[model samples]
Target chain A: MIELYDYELSSDAYKARLLLALLGVAWTQRYVEYYPRRQHRAPEFLALSPRGELPVIVDDGTIVDDAQNVLVHLASRHDPTGRWYPQNDAGLTSQVSTWLAFAAALTPTASAARLHDGLLYHHIDVDEARRGAHEQLAVLDEHLWFNEDAGWSWLCTVDQPTIADIACFPDVILAEEGGIELRTYPAIRRWTDRVKAIPGFIAMPGIFPA
Target chain B: MHGTSRWFPVIRSEEIVPRHIAFVQLLDEEIVLWRADDGALNAWENRCPHRGIRLSIGTHAGSEIVCRYHGWRFASGSGSCTLIPAHPSQVPPKAARVRSYQIRERYGFAWIALGDVEGEPSLPELDGLPHLTLRSMTFAAAAADVAATLASEPGIVVHDPYRAVWERMGDAAPMLLLLQPESSAMTTLHAVAGNDLTGAGRLAFLRAHNAWCKEIRPRIVSEESRSAQASR
Candidate 1:
């Protein structure tokens, strides 16, 4: 039995659920409350994590901590025809790699952006990161080059939305809140639509409580 | 402690510790790290200056710190106005502030930067490395500087495609670099499971990492040295 531990609104958990929900995988969930502030520090929670991240899952007692790992595990489990992960496709591999990198790599920037949007109008200190994002986005934007023959693929060459799209789109979709306008990039906006059209797709919750 | 221009990295992150109240390292600033006697990481500029508090001395008492001196309590990172002593809120913002760095925890470490940063700092890469217990270190260089150091020499040799790429697919590479500035940086070099990676294969990867470090790093430094010599 697959037992999932989720914290309701966490994107980390969402990545896991998005897959399970689409695959229609039956799993029991245990919701943990972590919002009283600093609750993750509780020994019980820290015990589950050495790095202390969330969206961890247990497959018959084997604990998976990192969210990206969870996604890969899910994709592999459901990869019947090798659609989600095309073994022959480095395009898919490299594409997926970029987003996974963002989710894990750009986290520090995301946390700062949240505060920037919340407390101050200007995000003065993270300019270096903004420039960094621009570089990353440019690369992503270039990869997103869509055409009649090659159009709107979600982080995969299969012409379908794979976990790769699921991974990259969330943070990029919310970039506007951090003063990043996704609308500025045509390919990004188009790719966002493709993800929405996929089955078992759930829209990102609105900011300020939806 | 090197005192090389103490930098209070701006509010570069949002989450510090979900449980323990701890302060992250600021660029070079003398940061006050403490838990509000409660279990929260509350950080401030580690200077008291009034009678010179060294703010770290205070502990959290429900989102407020009781200045060990006479049980004084101040709310917020601004270090302003006491609630316990019921001091007037007009304790001028300047006198009350302990200066706090915005902190966030991701991957496995807590990062705090001083001042208001522009936008957010994203998570770094995690694929390609061994997911063993990660030991990270930061030097006085931006991610871009390091990336430049790495990019100019994209020299990496994989022992086995399965081990380096597929088997350790989820693990980020040994050098997941992002260039941020000229100098001052953060790079997480991870080592994965040693189970399948035997002594020889693992040693090979290590040798590659060391060689990459040795090969590229010195070139830039030498180039800089030559330039400095030429200028002199």
Candidate 2:
């Protein structure tokens, strides 16, 4: 059995939960109070993750930290059809890895703004974070717009969705909490709707089902 | 607004697919645009009358739009509240309905009129020509200001206060552009290339125009900001 350390409000943790449900894998959630209690930074929790991230999954004594790594690990090991990770094709694998790295850039910008506005993390420079988020979103919108012309639905130039879609979903969907309106990014908005329509899709606190 | 009675292009026809809620703003009024599965086009006030929640964030359930907050369902054409999931047995009041606007599809674009519009959207330049709609872009400036700027350019022809048209030097097809006033400080541009392009040609044409839009957006935004600073 796999044990996932989770916080309900953490989008990073929700990524693991969403993939788990999509894969139909059995797992047990170990709730860790992230806000106010600050249990993620505690010594006991530091032994599992030194950087104090909310999501750290343990599967049969193998521990995986970081949201992107956990996604790659789960998809590589569990997905029988090899559609999610696509590690067999070198070109597709490189493209997926590139988007995974791009998804990491959202944490400090979009996620930081959300933290400052919604979670009382007043120490963050929200305006700067918001500006960075818009820049990133514009790149995403342009890419997705061109992808539509090629008749590709996902992030990569593939018919099926990859881990890149899952990696970027939570931050982009919950961007409104950070005062980031998606009205200008029409392609990105449509992509989010397509993502929500995927089979076995789940919602978080701010994101609604399609 | 004084221009409320006139038609303004809000979105491309293909963009408003069935079972999806598209949000747009016209002259500072938020609107929810959706197409029914039965091919009915609807443009309504973005707010849910029950709690003022944005209907743009609601679900498009084939023939109706369901408010995300309370699960209130409003039907397609009439905007009438059809069902209240909390109290399904009771009939909803007649007044419980969304305010709808006039919308018509013309030349591959969705033209919306916020007030009492007289007739269908008539454009002489388009005259039933084949066109490829480009991706829409929003600029941080007033619509009139953007239109005025374009009118001053060398080759661009200003058809009306809200419309413009231009052509590449040797190309047979003309590019017709429409301006949508999202607010006093924001404007969105919807464009169509008057040509029947397909496959790679369509992609290339769209990309070229998108690049042009990207170049112009910053110039307009910067000009607006500079003028705002001077006025202050």
Candidate 3:
């Protein structure tokens, strides 16, 4: 059995949960209390993830700490068709990798704003965080707009969603909690609907199933 | 200065599809724009009357928009509070209704007047031509400044404070530009060209106009900033 260290409201953890749900994989969630208790920083959790992140996953004997790594692991290992990671196609792999890095870039600005607003992390400069998130969202929106113009639905040009979609889904969907409105990014808004409509998709807190 | 009583173009008609909500701003007022299943368009204050959370982030059910924070539902057209899921049987009071603006569809755009208005919004003449709307662009400058920049372009005629017509230059087709005053420092420009040509010609025309708008946007913003600095 796989073990997932998760916090219910953490967008990072939600990414892991969403991918696990989409893959139809059976995994037991080890709930971590992020607020007040700060269980992610506790000694036992630190043993699993030295970086003290929520969403550390243990698949059999292998341990994956980062959310993106966990997504890659699950998709590469469990998916029979090799669709999610798409290692076979070099061009698609490059696109997925590029977006994965973009998704990582989103966490600091978008997810940090969410942490400041929703979790009362007052130390973060929420104004700057929101500005950064909006900048990133504008770029993503333009990309999706052209994608729609070319009749593609997912983040990449391919018809099926890559792990890159799962990587970027949580922060963009929950950006409003951080005072970042998706209204200005209509294409991104429509992309969120497509992500939600994926087979075996599930919603975490603040993200309703569409 | 433009008053809140006058109608402003909020968004293009094609932007707000069924079951989707578009967020719009008019003169510093945040507005939620949505199209109902019945094809009726709605323009309401973007806040849920319950908790002041933005209704723009909420879901658009076929007939109503449901608040994400609390499961409060607001009806389309009327903007009346229809249901509170937690309360179940209890009907919300009349005061729970969200404030709505008068919205009308004209010339392929939704026009919203913040306060009560007496007559229809005046629009430029594009009634007979088959037209294509260019991608709307937002500028970090006042609407008046953006309008001035557009009017200054050679062969362009300003119809009014909010509308302009750019005459054909070279192979480019004649196009209309409409400005929406989002706030004191922000503006959105919507463009439409007569769809006299089809296929590659139309694509090239849209590309050319879109590129031109993108090129001028930064210049307009910088000019506005310079003017502000000079005034100071």
| Cα lDDT tens digits for candidate 3, B1-232 | 4767777777778778678778888888899888889998889998999999988778889999999889899998888889999997998889989898899987667899877787996544566766677677777788878888887788889887788888876734567788888888888888877667666766676667768877887668545476787899
RMSD of each: 20.3, 2.1, 3.3
Error of 2 at A136 (Å): 1.3
**lDDT of each residue in A1-210, candidate 3, tens digit only:** 889998889888888888888778899988999997999999988887889987898889789988888888889998887888899889999999888888889888999999998898999999999999988997898778667766788889999999999999999989888998776677888788788878999998888776
Candidate 2 chain B weakest ten by summed lDDT: B217-226
Model 1 alpha-carbon drift over 4 Å, by segment: A88-95, A115-129, A146-149, A207-210, B1-232
What digit string (tens of lDDT, one per residue) describes model 1 on residues A95-161?
6766677666545554345435644626455565455555565556545642211444565555666
lDDT of candidate 2 over B1-232, digit per residue (tens): 5688899889888878667898899998999889999999999999999999999899989999999999999999999999999999989989899999999998888889988888888666667688778988888788877887777666789888789998668778788888999998889988887789887877788889889888776556445565786799
Would you list the rank order by DockQ, best first?
2, 3, 1
Per-residue error at B108 for model 1, in Å? 49
Q: Give chain A TM for each model in order.
A: 0.80, 0.98, 0.97
After TM-score superposition, what is the CA distance of residue A179 in candidate 1 from its true location, in Å? Answer: 2.7
The best candidate by lDDT is 2
Each candidate structure's TM-score, on Cα atoms with residue i matched to residue i, is 0.43, 0.95, 0.85
Provide the DockQ value for model 2. 0.70
